[model samples]
Target: MALAIFDLDNTLLGGDSDHLWGEFIVEQRIVDPAVYKERNDAFFNDYLAGRLDIQIYLSFCLQPLAEHSAEQLVAWHAQFMREKIEPIMLPAARELIRKHRDAGDTLMIITATNRFITAPIARAFGIDILLATECEKADGRYTGHSTDIPCFRDGKVTRLDRWMLENSQSLDDSWFYSDSINDLPLLSLVDHPVAVDPDDKLRAHAEANGWQVLSLR
Candidate 1:
């Protein structure tokens, strides 16, 4: 079976979902503006530079989930989806996903963003399988910690390999669409690699490798 995997942030949307999620929380007054806003900006910048420390970043991002009940998060996320995520949906990205889906490919969104932030976004795109950074829970609340290696950089390949093993799938007939140099491991692993609005390094690598480069935006 053909497997089609997509990176969620800049690849599928017009912007970064994780950064937008931080902005949404700050705008909603869910986090302390005095503290979180600056940190959020720094983290986003770090991510763009491909220097994000996932553990430290997740500690900040997931803390809000831990402070609120699941019900509250669900309601707040519904609002977040309406106010932020929906507007950034790229039409071409949706069409590409649809094309793959219509071809009976096993479709998935694999993102470094946490599940709490990305699951709904994946659903909005009509994708059922999302491999994202796992948030640990305890006593029906978030622990503000990741339970497994984040689905990021080389870790994306690790998570994808485990998923393939569990589902009896293989990358031999897979296609991966991504925008970051960080995803090089999985991009190299897949039979068909597409760089969608890729970063400078990734674009250079894609060109060097003769991979298809596209712009969803």
Candidate 2:
């Protein structure tokens, strides 16, 4: 079966959940005022600007939980998923996800979002696979950095190539849906490059390239 990879941020959802989650995390005091807020803000800025280095972004986001136990971080992530992601999921996005599920497609949430947040949200949506930036950890504590290549645009294709090699599959018949120009590398890797509410750059390229462009809200 071919894969259907969907981006999680503005493509699937109505907006960027990363900034909102950062604000929420700070407001709830799950992170420290001195570091968490500053680092997450930096990450948010870089992410929006499409300049975020995946490794550093993952590291900084997880830095707050370095002192906390793994279980505690998991619990916090669970709470963040419920409190932050559920309410923000657009009805149209939910419907689209359901449609993908009903089609028996092997759907994967391919995003730069962290595993802690995207993992539970994907599980709740009945999506089995999530390829995201995983934070480095040791002895149940975060190292404030990525242990693997953060699943960004080009990084996504790199990571997927390895996975596909092991699984005996290819991107020749796959579908990719995303909203950002930053996702162009991964989107182009697939046979069906769908631009969903894409940024201006992606939209222009999609039009010129004759790729299918979807507008969700």
TM-score of each: 0.97, 0.89
Give the Cα error of residue 66 in candidate 1, in Å. 0.8
lDDT digits (tens) for residues 1-217 of candidate 2: 7788889888777777677677777888877765777877887777667787766566566667576778887787777777777777778877888887788777888888777667777777677878887877777777766668878878888888888898787776789999988988888778899999888888899999999989778
User: What lDDT is obtained when candidate 1 is compared to the true structure?
Assistant: 0.92
- Best candidate according to lDDT: 1
For model 2, the stretches where C-alpha displacement exceeds 4 angstroms are 32-39
Assess candidate 1 and give its TM-score to the true structure.
0.97
Measured over all alpha carbons after superposition, the RMSD of each candidate to the real structure, in angstroms, is 0.9, 2.1
Which candidate tops TM-score? 1
